[model samples]
Every structure is written in C-alpha cells, then in structure tokens.
Target: MEGVVSVNPNHVCKLHTTRSWDFLNLTLKDVGSPQESDVIIGLLDTGIWPEHPSFNDTGLGPPPSKWKGACTGQNFTCNNKIIGARYYNSDNSSDISDIQSPRDSIGHGTHTASTSGGVEVAGASYFGLAEGIARGGVPKSRIAVYKVCWAFGCSYADILKAFDDAIADGVDIISVSLGSPWPSDYFDDPIAIGSFHAMKNGILTSNSAGNSGPNPVTVSNFAPWSLTVAASSIDRKFVARMELGDGQILAGTVINAFDLNGTSYPLIWGGDGANYTIGSSPDIARYCLNGAMSTDKVAGKIVFCEAGLDGSGVLAANGVGTIMSDALIVNPDYSFSWPLPATLISPEDGKTVLDYIRSTESPTATIFFSNAWKDVMAPKVVSFSSRGPSAISPDILKPDITAPGVDILAGWSPLAPSTVYQDDTRSTLYNIISGTSMSCPHASGAAAFVKAAHPNWSPAAIKSALMTTAHVLDPSKHEDLEFSYGSGQINPLAARDPGLVFDASETDYINFLCKQGYNTSTLRLVTGDNSTCNNIKPGRGWDLNYPSFSLYVKDGEKISAIFTRTVTNVGAANSSYTVTFDMPPLISVTVEPPVLVFSYVGESNTFTVNVTGPVISQWPITSGSIKWMDGTHVVRTPLVVYNYLPGAPYNLDSEQAYTMTRESLGLTHSNVYHKTGMGQSRAHPQFL
Candidate 1:
C-alpha cells in the first residue's frame, strides 16, 4: 500500500530522435571523463538493445559500487556501459508486447539510452545522413535500463515499480520519455509520484514535454520537481526543393534521401486521378486516402497529396513521387522525409502548385534532395514541441529547458522497422528521429555532465545551473517567449559553471505537496514514508523556490502576488550580485533586497518578488525575467504571467483560497476566455 498504488493502462505515444554533440558542444573528447562513468542515468522506457554498438562498453570499467540493481531474465545481461537492468509488468494481460524479457523489441529504449550516455560510435550515420562521430552528451556515463513500457504503452503500476527500484538502485538521474496527454494531479499521476521520490533520493528526473503541440496547455510532466524538456532544432537542417513547370522553385524541410538528379516527371493532382465510381470521390482522393486514387492513373506520376495522407500508401499505389502540404499553416521551415521521394510544402505553396497544375496541359515538376543547410536562424522551438503554461500547477514552468530534438541520429534497434508501416522490414544500426522524447535524454545527459562536474550538488542545484545559464533566443535572434521555450535552449558547457543556483531540498517539495492539499494518507502513498500535512501551512504553489516565476491573473481582474526564491552562490567567494528586473507592460514588478553579497561559496540569499498586474484579455500570456548580475556572471530566472479565469465545467475547488489564488491563473481553459473576448480585446505589448 505504501508503494505503487494501482495500475492504469494507457495507449502508446510515438517516437522522436539526434549532430547533437556538435550542436550542444558536448563532443566526447572535450566533455567526456571518467568521473561521469560513476554517474548512472536510469532510463525507464521499452528496454535496451545491449548488442547495439552504442552500448559496446569498450573502455568502461566495472559497475559502480553504489549500484544496487541487478540484471533480470535469462539472456538479459548488463555490460560495463549499461550497469543494471530491470523489468516490471504487474498486469498479466496478453496484449503486452515483449513482456517475457527485458530486451527492447521496440527501438525507443535503445534510441533514448544511447542519447543519454551511449559510448562514442565513430562513422555513425543514418542512411548516410548526419555522418560523423556520434556520441551522447556524456559518453562515459553509465546507463541502467528499467523496462516499464511495452508496445501498448507504459503501465502506471510498472512505472512506479521501476522508480522504486531505480531510486533504491542509486541512480544519479532518471530519464523518462513518456507522458500522458492531459495533466493529472500529483497524487494520482504515476510520473508525478515516481519523480517525487526520485527527487527525495537526490536524483534528478528529466522528462519529455509531450509531442502534442502548437496547442496551449498540452504540456505533460508538469510537476515542479521534475525537469520537463521541450524539443527544438539545431543549426543543421534537412531540406528538399521542388521545381515546377513555370520555373517556380519552392523549398521545404525533410530528411529526403532519394535524388531525382534533375529529372522531371509528369505531375498529377490526386483528385484528378480519382475513380468516382469506386467511391473514391475527388475530395477523398485529394487527401490520398486508401483506395481513393486508382493505380492506373497514379502509376509513374508525381501525385500532389493533401496533409494527413499516407505517403507510404501513395507510394504503394504506384505513385513515383509525392508532394504534401501542411494541414494547419505554411511553415517552410518544417518538413519530414517519407518512404518515397517526397517533400512537404506549406498550405500557401500548395495552393500555388494547384493553380499552376490546373492552368497547364502537361504539368511537370522536379523534386530533389537538398544538401544540409546551416540555419543562421537556428534553435527555434519546433511547431510540434509541446508548449506550456503548466496545466497541473501553473505556478511552476513545465518544460525546464529545450534541446536539439529535431532529426537527431542515434543508435537504432535492429529488431525494429525504420518506417511506421509494419511491412517495411528495413533495419539499420543508426536512425534519425525527432520529438521531446529525443530532447529529454539530451537534458538528462546535460544533467549528468553537471553532476560529474559538481558531484556534491543536489538535483535542484543541478536543475538551477541549467536553467540560470540557458540562452533565451530563437533562431531568428529574437528573444523567445518563456512559455514556448522555458528558460531557453540548454547550454551544457555554460551550465557547469552557473554562478548561482536556486536550490530546493526534499523537505521543500514535501511542503509543496502539502500545500497542494495531499493529506497524510496520500503523502505516505507518494513518498513511502510516514508523512503528514498537519504542521505544514497551506502555502502558495508558486512559493516552492523554483528556478522560474509563474504568476497567473484572471481576465478583467486586478491581482497582486508575491514570490519568494533563494539562490546559492556557486561562483567565486565575496561575489556581490545586484538584481535587475525586466518587467512587461500591464505588469509591475519590484524586488526586495536588490543587492546580494556572498562572502563564501555555497552562501545563499533569499529574495522576494512582489508582482502587480491587471489581467488584459488581449494577451493571454506575457512574460518578463529577473537577472542577478554579479558583473562576471548573470543568474537569470524567467517570469511568466498568464490570464486564467475560473468558472464552470472544470469544477475546480473554490473553497481552497490558495487553489482560488492558484486557479486565478488557470491555463487549461484560458482559450475559452480568449474566444469570448475576440475582437473586443486590445492588443498588449509583447514581452520576451
């Protein structure tokens, strides 16, 4: 009863995977060290592919004495690089895939494990793409895999079991790339509960900010104690170019391998090739749905398909090439490579291509793979990377940071297929994938990098180092909004020496849980200890001493809130930092004790921020930041303020004043208010 309460089954979320090293400046020769070999990163996912070259050990030593976990199953064994292995599956359901062993039948675990601490694999490439020495953020660090997730999805009971074992096994960090679609209470959510225990055990947990994105309040893994990671791109990008009959050229993004070699083919729209008599209507054919386009009409022709169409299916229908458009907007910067020679253009460009095809009798176009381009405007948050205004606890920022998650090349499981389709049997040692799942391990490796550097630092201190030293800029050199990119893109090299860190201990988090209204019985279930909220005051969730500040305001209401945070001086002794505020319009911010002087390392100073602002309906979310400038170092904390109005349907507790205070900044249903005000609301000034 004290440990893993009950198991709930959930559906599986898809994959995303990694020059990542050069992108993050985490080359093995520069950052790798034996110190990291002692640092263990516990991976909770499908399982590990031990035979993969990435986990070959090579120069690694024996397992650390601190490790308490054991290798499970008959054939499953651990190497020097992969120190421990465990599996958990309480449900005897027949739907489970690969349940008899700890070995990964799915590719996700192998990919994530490699990204976190896989050994350096030279000449690593995915089908001749991203060719170079591929390595994790900290190549020398040891990895321990906990197979909690099978093919169906991760079970809540199994996840909790993995966490209990991982914590007891003395893992330095936990990297989980799974999450639910909606936010759940910390008491009920397995991730939230498991991560809480990991935090208590002095281990940092890095999690994925789910792939459901460009949508507000879709972020998962929002617990303040865990480090939620978002996905972004690096300088190198994959692209494809299209040349139309009118000499018009359009460019899009994708990992296209096939080269047309300047050859042109007859281009036909799917709708024009539809056989209406077979119920393949023009509209349905435009989408390129199954059985919508006739093989006779599509054979050897470059077919233009709509968004959501199965490119592989089109290729199966004898289509030589495919040009697809985005469903939402025309984003020239975003694209994906399909099984066939294909390119994805924006919706606007799709219209132009359609117009040209209708006008010309013999429409012809050439599609070719373009060489990798170094984006001057790099590090923009990918559209698919989940956005936040943390739905669970708006006071705390969900994604602690962003990393290079787009089109990363890493080790792949030979047992798994490269394509999404089951019949595609193509396998490779290295593969390219993308998502926050990829980003999570990037952050985890960075955390391990910091842990190796400062072995004495707590998880909170490690998290603070990363957050305070992050860079807050988009690819275009514009200041990125806080909610979109969290603190900003992670700077692994810079994080190791962050001058000051906002640190919190296990007791601090227990206090936070108490404030969240968990009673003694619930607290015991979460922490597996005799705990009570009796002596703890029901405080504000924002006062949890987080690295960032999140203040909520309801529409048409005036509110004033105070946030208290403490920073530990990790730089040189006798350092004096003067506080400076970047306040957004419609909000006024003032800090108490603007100057902090520390005469010794590890010295700490607490500061209070009093923020007053009116809820402007026009701007649903606005942001600002505070910097502690010590001349040589800048310790920054991003400040986010959103408009959250509490009312019907949600049935949020109004009895609890702090909940009301916290609920005032609700992010979940903020769109309802945005829709109601529409044209009447005046535009507010942008803050970044």
Candidate 2:
C-alpha cells in the first residue's frame, strides 16, 4: 500500500473488421515487406483457435531469437507463425460458453489474432460474402497470443497481468482490442500503465478507441505512450433488397444469404395478427413485441413489424417472413445475416410499405438474397468508432489513426456462432465483424511492418512514422478533423520510410504526465527511478513531442500560444525540409526557423511554432495541418484551435468534476489562477 498511488476498481472492460488490407493497397503481391519474419505481434483478447488455417506455419521459420515467451495454454499449440500462446483469468471466472484454456470459445481473440498477423488464407469468405483472400497487413509477421478476456468481459487485473506478461514475453508490438467504459488517469488505467512499461522496453502498444462513437469524448485509450486507433471503412459494403407487388424495390440492411427464388408471400401487418387479450390491435401488434402476434392470423404470412426486431416473435407465430423498420439506421453501410427471411427497412420505407399494404386488399412482397456493392464513401469513420478530445490529456490527440474496422473478415472460432443472431446455426472458419477492436490490429500489423523495416526505431518513432505518413482524409467527410480521424488513415508502406518522425522517449512522456499533473514523488511510483517533473514546461499539453498540435481558447479571447516540437530525420541523407501550413480559418500560424536541414539520417531538428492572432470567436472547433516537405517526402500532422464553450465557466459542480491544481497548472504557467466558477483564458480546457 505504501507504493500505491491510486486504487481502481477491477472494472470489466468490454471486447470491442476485415478486408481491408487490399483497400489500403497492402496486398499480398504488392506489399514489399522487409524481414517481417522476426517481428512478433502480441494480442490481448479472448483466446485463439489454434487449429484455424490462418495459423498454419507452412513457410514460416522458428520463433524469433528475441521471443522469450512460451506456450502455457493447456491443449493449445503455437506454431511457427504463432510463436506463443497463453491465457489469463485472474478471477477464475467461467461461463457456460467459456473454454478453460487459451483456446478461443468466443472467437474474438481468434478474429483479432489472425487479423493482425494471420497467414494468407485463400478462399476466405464470410458465408460467400465479401469473399477474397483474407490477409493481415504483414502476413509474414509472427504472432504471440495472450488471452486476457473471457465471457464476462476483460478484467482490469487480468488485463494488467497480460500486459506484464506481454512485456516480459518479448513482444515487439502489443495489440489490445478491449478497453474500459471510460478512460482513467494513466497511472490508474491498466492498458496505459502496461503500455508505458512496454514503451520503455521498446514495444509499441496499439489499442482500440472503444466502440462508443458518433459521440464525442468517448475514447478510452488515450495514453501518449501507446497508440489509440479509431475505426473506418474499406471500399466495400453489403445490402439486401425487398420487392413490392408493383415491382418497387427498396434496398435495406441485412445479410440475407437465404434465397427465396423470387417467390412472393402474402404480407400481413403485425396488428392484424395481434395476440391481444382484447382481440386484434394493430398498434400493439405493430411492434410484434415478443408473442404479441397471434399464430393463426400470422401463420404462413410475411409479417410486417412496423418498427421492431420481432424476428423471434414472428417466428413463434409461424410467420414465413418478416419486415422490420428502424428509424435510426440511415444509410448504414454494414449488415449481418439473419436465419429467417428477414430485412430491416428505414422508418420512411416502413410507412410507404404500410401504405402499399393498405391500398391493396392483398399485399405481397418478396425478400431477395443479400448482395455486395462498392460504397463511394469508403474509409469514412464508422458511427461506432469512438471519438475524442481525450479527458486524460486534453492537449494530446487520441485515436492516433483510423484503420478499416467495419465488416472485417478474419479468423473465427468454430466454437462460437458466426453472426450476432444466436438462432442462425451456420458456422464458418472466418467471420465478418466490426468495431475499433478490428482497427487496432490493422494498426498493430502496420506498426510491425514499419518496425520490421527499421528495427532500430523506437516505439515513438514507429508511431510517428505511421501518423505523419498517413493518408490525409477528406476534411469534408471528417468534420471533427483530427479529433475524429487523428492524423488520418494509416498508410503502412509510406510509414516504412517516413521522412521525419516525432519521436518521444521516456523522459518526454514523463514530462507529458507531469504537465498532466503528476507530482515528482507520485510520478516516481510509476517510473520507479530518479524521474522528476522539474523540467516540465508551463503548458496544458503542447510541450510533449506529439505528432500534432491542439490549443484551447475561450470565446472572444485573443489567441496566443507557442508550441515547440522536435523531429528526428529518418529519411535520405542531406535532406532539406521546409514547413507548410494549411492555416485554420482566421488564425495566423508561423513556424520559426522553418527550414530543417538534416546532414544525415537520425539527425534531430527542433522547431517552435508561435501564434498571435486577433480575438477569435469560433464556438466549437476548426482544424488544419502543416506539412514539412523535402520535395520527395512530405511529413504532415494536424493543427487545431477550438473553444468548446462560448461563455461557460469552469464546471466544478459536476458529479465527476475536473479540478486542476496550482502546483501543476497554476504555479508553473504564465496566466495562472484558481477559478471558483466559469472563467476565460486563452489556453483553457479543450473540450467540445
């Protein structure tokens, strides 16, 4: 207890993709992976299905010499491709569906493990949908599985233990696909603490951004030492169609693999078959709320449940088919196959179908099989990928980059059900799933690729390569800019040879934590060395050697701040770099000594970007980027200025209040003060 800084609940974190390599152009034939045979990617999830073809060792050599891990799971074997396998359940937790060893029963671990470094598997498909050669970013990279999650979700203690084992086990990159309900302090978060240790040992940890998105401030992995990945899309999508009697076709969402062969079924509204004690009531039966429909009335009829997931209800009533409606799902590009002849239509479509049914005495419709199509809006961040302006570190950007997460086809366990619907009894080797969980492994594999090419690079350097060399996303699609997509979607090949990398060492992170308010002695509890916060500069966040820059200003405050950043050149020798800015609206940004000349590789250059602008009144946020171009390679990172609240004061009365300390922010800063209520400042909390 003496060394304990804080106590956190052993909160059970939830488990949160596919193609997608070809979408990024990291194809099996095109990708020139350099010596990736030795790179080991450690996965922390449920567990792996060792017998899956994706884990086949075929041409792979033995484990890397640096791999000090072991296969400790009972009855679980690790091949040359998967160098190690182990499982952790500190609470000895068990579910009826859980397996007792590292063997995956839930399939999440297998899905993620193979997604990160699975061997190339030909004829890989999800029930003949989105069919293609399933492959990871670096197919040749070795995998080490650490199963920390179970049926009840991942325990923080187990997660911490897995992190400890992963670090000690000599993993080159750690891929964690689970996270807490919310991000805690770095010292308190198991992933953060473990990743910090991993970073110290030259291992980069890539974590999911959490699947609570389309909503802001939901990111759960925000530690600067690790990479927090957001979820995006690839170039593909899926849909199902329903045809009315008049031949009017309505495209809906559902992976209906079942083919009715153009057979029309009589349509009956749920209300017509209401099992109400008071007799037929369309209003009550409309939702088809479990057992609401009468079996005799709905039997052999295509039931139209106005707005509900009454697939089971319809089935119990002996309905041949069902049409459901959801008002919320608008233009969603993903769907899953249901066991029955089913399709989910939009609320507007539901109304039109209801009208068609009313107008015709005998309404009939046919549901067709699911089909695949190209989505022009591919690579847009999915609605479920968590958003951020991190609560842990406001100045630093979270979800460092976006990767393909929606509808990812990867290795799955035969022990688990393929789709979310339990009634569907179909099983498969690979399953299509979506979440930030899928995106994390893509980034991890990419990081492995970069690390394999540049073995001498630090964890931070590899991260910088991925971030700076990423493809800049369309600002029109990502209105939140860096907060939503970070440095944009990852580009692994470009990352292998990033011209410049914003590298940060242990001391740099210590300073970042110091700026986040950790005092010297408390910080010692973490670093366990003679680390001090004395060198911490007076800033909310920009002082750290982060890839991007973010500043917070209050309403009508004259914007002024200075950000100093350092970059280590990893490009060609005798390279000259000059900075260019996509300046934010109505804000002036100037970089001093803009030209950075690197005499040789690994040479470091530091630059200070100063800003002095007129009183700005943008209530929410505006973002831009600066590119350091050397004519051959361009290194880019986002620059943002925002004011979350127009005239709001520092909220100190909340249920979970964020109270800043003077020793951390007040005593060290130029414009420091203790605010009892709402106050205004040039550089305040950046929340929107």
Best by TM-score: 2
Q: What is the TM-score of each candidate against the true structure?
A: 0.89, 0.91
Checking candidate 1 for backbone clashes, the offending pairs are 16-434, 17-433, 17-434, 18-408, 18-409, 377-475
lDDT of 1 by residue, 470-583 (tens): 987652432336666899989888899999999998788888888877777777766767777888866568689899988766667675789888888999998999999887
Query: For each predicted model, how many residue pairs clash, with residues at least 3 apart or on different chains?
Result: 6, 6
Give all candidate RMSDs, comma-separated: 6.2, 7.4
lDDT for model 1:
0.76
Which candidate achieves the best lDDT against the true structure? 2
Return the lDDT, model 1, position 595: 95
Q: After superposition, how far is residue 541 of candidate 1 from its true place, in Å?
A: 2.4
Question: What TM-score does model 2 achieve against the real structure?
Answer: 0.91
Off by over 4 Å in 2: 1-7, 32-34, 277-281, 308-310, 528-530, 535-538, 645-688
